[model samples]
Target: MKPFSGTSLTDHALTTGEVLLTYWKVKAEYQWDAGLAMSTYLNGLKQGKLLGIHCPQCRRTLIPPRVFCELCFRPLDQWVELANIGKINTYSVSYVNWDATRRQTPEVPAVIEIDGASPGMGILHLMGEVGDTLEAITRRLKVGTPVQAVWKPDSEREGAITDIRYFRPIG
Candidate 1:
């Protein structure tokens, strides 16, 4: 209680016990709608398929389907099916897990440009079955390397992004 000297406020202000602190735990629950575009896209994943929206004007097929074309500013009504196979656009090897914990086996995340979609149209997914070590994975995988989605078993799919467990290099 040495007046919390380093704080931005004047030392005397805190030393006098003028500041009040409190903590509260609140619980709230809510439902989220994925909207028309995303709902369809996620459902397709549950069925072991990839879905996208096509902009007739711009002629770009977009994954993680949007309701409207960003470039053309028009409603996207036409839905197109995309191939699970794609080429790795770029990738990174992570030594840290999502929770900031050190991982013995590094995670490989990559942007993959799906086949049959417009150029540069891709999805973010993890790479698996590449290799056991960082060096081996880096040496074996590269930009433009062909890959395919590895989906969860049909019974395990829950209509979520994780429906497809990860992408792996195709032989």
Candidate 2:
């Protein structure tokens, strides 16, 4: 057996100038299936409607429909058509874009509790047509303020969440 003999790298050596490093940016692309539950939900949006799933055991309706109940651990199949109107459960005002760029108009994202779904069951969405200034939007919109979906023209819907352009305060 030959004993190993090599120069051990030290932290100071690596930190100073003893080590060489390389960096690369790789581009990747992919596609995925939305499955039965999500596909139906998205299709419902394209038709200017909100859809949810019902759990018979717990008697609770869930938005962003799931194939199973989290509480009962039961497979869910019953589908319920929900109303486009809902109340804002919570929200956030963002001045930065998704790419971390600053923007003049702030984006308001909120969790809206759909009318037909169980209480406290909500979906995360953006609020639009509210107001331009921070003070105006904050003054007009509240946690429980009612809002309705603003759908794009029927001809433009593409079976995606964006089909509902955004939700705005209902009067």
User: Against the true structure, whose lDDT is highest?
Assistant: 2
Q: RMSD, model 2, all Cα superposed?
A: 6.5
Candidate 2: list runs displaced more than 4 Å. 1-21
lDDT of 1: 0.91
**Top model number, TM-score:** 2
lDDT of 1 by residue, 7-57 (tens): 567778767878865679889888999999999889999999999889999
lDDT of 2: 0.93
lDDT scores of the candidates, listed in order: 0.91, 0.93
lDDT (tens digit, per residue) of candidate 2 on 59-132 = 99999899999899999999999998999999888999879999898889999999999999999999998887
lDDT of 2 at 70: 86
lDDT of 2 at 135: 93
Q: Model 2: what TM-score?
A: 0.85
